[model samples]
Target: MSNRPITPLLDKVCCPADLKGLSDDQLKQVAHELRQEVVSAVSETGGHLGAGLGVVELTVALHAVFDTPRDKLIWDVSHQCYPHKILTGRRDRIRTLRQEGGLSGFCKRSESEYDAFGAGHSSTSISAALGYAVARDLGTAPEAGVGDAIAVIGDGSLSAGMAYEALNHAGHLGKRLIVILNDNEMSIAPPVGAMSRYLNRLYAGAPFQEFKSIAKGAIRHLPEPFQEGAKRAKDLVKQVTVGGTLFEELGFSYVGPVDGHDLDQLLAILRTVKTRATGPMLIHAITKKGKGYAPAETAPDCGHGVSKFDVATGVQKKAPANAPSYTKVFAEALIREARADRKVVAVTAAMPDGTGLNLFAERFPERIFDVGIAEQHAVTFSAGLAAGGQKPFCAIYSTFLQRGYDQIVHDVAIQRLPVRFAIDRAGLVGADGATHAGAFDTSFLANLPGMVVMAAADEAELVHMVATAVAHDEGPIAFRYPRGEGVGVELPEKGVPLEIGKGRIIQEGKRVALLSFGTRLKEVREAAQALSAEGIEPTIADARFAKPLDEDLILGLAREHEALITIEEGAIGGFGSHVAQLLAERGVFDHGLRFRSMVLPDTFIDHASAEAMYAEARLNAADIEAKVRDVLSGATAQAARRA
Candidate 1:
């Protein structure tokens, strides 16, 4: 509160409408104030810092010129919507970012009308904006009154195939749409691919200070009232070509490579394009990620994402890690496998750093591939690698892997390719919320035939799973691990390949058997200890493989224990469902076995800490303990009825 900046110009602005009243100089002042507010707020409540900082001037200029909430302004993968959120009457709640019961880190349609299209994934903006433009043309929602549809996409987003698909379609449709290329030359990671290179050339060749064209003068020279006579027919087709660029080829009137931070240049270019654009138009604005903040600007990731930090020093106030993170563990295990086998290579779809493949890339640079933001290609490419007798480990985040599901099914599953899918962030991820949560991967992957699905109970288990994936050249195998640190378990010096489709018992006890999958075993163990206190002493068995079902272990648990409870960090149709199906088919339920599955609720959870999210999901230690007691009581009731 003490560090909050004085914003005389910005204080007057209540909404985007208020921005329209401010002079260009005052708007520039507002942008400066907005940047200060962003930096200050993020220092207390960390979130996407660099992206918001990058687009301060662009955000101000767009709101100042365009009629948003009416004219659909879509931000591609709207992580940078924090400043936009602040300007659109949400500054009061800015400090509560990424906290429980607070504002979401990403743009949400439910949160505000100004956020035209909600996005947590990248490269969907062009398609969404095009849909809005088409809807406006078709008079689909006349009463709502949608105007010029604008998509502000980053340079890295263009690397995805979806953006180009929309571009190709938009060119064909020839609608009055607008696309702003927010060319920061990076997206979370330093961008790669031909598209990134092409954009780089555009950025390098263009005069950074000026617009690509003198757009205002051209619009001025054209007469507003064209003749209705036979002579008017000659100029029917508007021969408007701002510049012969790539966007022009896509049927968009190309405008910039303009200085995004320069308010005068941004306002002028936006205003000129806003008036003159008939068909689809593109304005390329070059911006520096984390522009104002020196600490962020100089950093490797440009402070892409951060924890709460001191404003002066820019040092994060993170709690000391008790154990290595699951990501690091995964990277270390993967590196070990790669070292032992020349055929063992890694592939990541734009998330080398996020998936911990960056570490792998440092050692075996030639063997590692960072395919830029294209998960679909990454999956099929790995499948191809496997087909060529190479063990390609496709390291992707669980949520991101969903994008490549069709490829996984068609390319990997059908052929039974041994593409080791290292699914990172495999459970209820915090902050990024429901969109980024890896809830469905288990269900989706396990459903496929010949697919081996395994979840790591701890960092040590993760090592074995990596080894298992490498050794198993039979079919497609996947191993999932959660995002944060492990429970400080001592890791093995080298991983031993696990026996396929088998489970290991942790604690053999009496009345109830707790069948655990994934990282939830930690909570299960805690519940067992608490249950031991109550004289319950429930048995705990880690179900290492989800797909293959571990039939012998599962059936033994069902027959031996009075009650059996299955726990997993996945949704309904995953491990528990598979176990349920097995028991049902084998008539275990018919033999009076009291079975229950504890899973994430059939609802989309909002952003919170992983602990808070698990509480809401009702899959914590207490919840597990409660389920065991409840089931045991039910089993006793059944026994009394039999007597």
Candidate 2:
């Protein structure tokens, strides 16, 4: 690797405050250098690339125009914060982006003051900025000028209902806020839904610009007395001609469809918007995802997130010969089932490739639906599909599912709709970190009245769960799996449906019982083996159904073993929480039995290698062994004390 000294301009810019001194030309150069820095950093670290690349000039322009830390600039989704990170006191540490103990992959409030508001999920910035703007308005002493709240959001994010909700509210509240719509025509995949279509029409047609030019020409031709009347006529013409009167009707003074990449235009527009705009205003800026990089630009699925790659050739590193990922396994299983059964359909909220449904989309184009970034809509839409005698497998990442919690609870669970949720990335997502971790799915879904929650112990079990979901037509069911490749088990040609609310004993032993949930079975097995070396043969049971808990299997294990440990890849209220509730209800804990729960610690794990994050959370094999040993040793000490 060639070692290069950090440029002096970059090194000097610790914050947006420092950027105020730079000339506009220097700012443009800085934007270019920042993009290069982002490219270099993400090439090494591997993160959200296209979004950041698209926003480099915007980032530079925003910081140059606004008083950032003071002005509370919130980036929607925050995936595009690489350039923001590079500008705000993190230039030297850019290489460590997304690594454990390094700079966060997204904007994190705890990480830096410049972050303003943390975001991982999209459509949150407008709401967050509005909140800040309101707070600033409420906090203003007579002498203090209004603090600015700038929300930089992507066109893809605008598809979500929450974004529109915030826009409506922001407009009604009449807050001093600036919403910068970064129209890149992409989310991870090409954006879908009506909003994306509207943006395309607005930008592609150039009708607004054409109308504005025509009005100006008309004004030049009109006499002085007629000029004033023509201007009012022009306003009426704009209302009919320019489509953004929708925003104006909502109370926001809508601005431009300006070139986001143009440094001078962005700065000039932002400067004018910053000073002149009274209420909420949206400056629509058109941008290209993966602007500088040609390979990413042309790639149909715009280079959103990528693996570590060779920047020169744009070649992604080849995967090692290993088992197919759980996502791929889930996809294959779904495809096999769909081929056999016509009722089986699939849905993904802006994540066909991520959820491994791209294969399904290609094969069964008619059955699959890609609901852009709108998780709530995807859930309710799936409910509609299910009600229409179709088995809609709403395949979503665990974290993204959080956005549709209300829909799942109300539309699916309450009404008892048979919407199969193929929840991928169901545990701690490495590199993307805590915001993307699927740690709450089990806990949240389990509490829903009629919801059936299952966790896959391995790829094979994931296939079984998919079959189980297909077979069950009573209520909402969710099957969760991790982010990476599955264990090297050969996939069965046909998936066999599993018995609902049942668990199987993987290994039978004595003294201690290790109840494993999800893909953490591998670690549990290793920990059990280590315990065996110490003459403690622990029983290992895979609690397949998180909600139902396999009560018979759990009670049997609790009675047979001296101590019980429930392990899951989620937070406190998940599988472990269910197990705890079961044990308490059965009066098993009345004997004062030695019980321990192994759940992800109540902390936001940083971006890092999966192994490293697991190790940090003490969920890795070694850490699992240590925890098991500690619990067993504690049981021994307690026994001695009782005696």
Per-candidate clash tally:
0, 0
Q: Where is model 2 more than 4 Å wrong at Cα?
A: 1-12, 140-146, 207-243, 318-321, 641-643
Query: Model 1, 249-311: lDDT tens per residue?
Result: 776656545678878777876776677667777777789899999999988999999999998
lDDT tens per residue, model 2, 1-643: 4634345577678888888999999898788778777777778878888888999999999999998677888999999899998888888788888887898888998888788899999999999989888877787522334479899999889889989899999978987788999998888887888887777776455553453444334334323322242133234335335446567767776655667787866776677566656677787777889999887788777678888888887777767858888989999999999999999999998888999999998999999999899999999999999999999999999999998999998889999999999998988888898889988999899998888999999999999999999999989899999988888987787889999899999998988888999889998898888878888788999999988779999999988888898888899988888888999998999876778888999997888888888888888878777777788789889889989
Model 1: residues with Cα > 4 Å off, grouped in runs: 206-244
TM-scores across all candidates?
A: 0.95, 0.92
Least accurate stretch of 10 residues (summed lDDT) in model 2?
A: 224-233
**TM-score result, candidate 1:** 0.95
Output candidate 1 Cα RMSD: 3.2
Say which candidate scores most in TM-score: 1
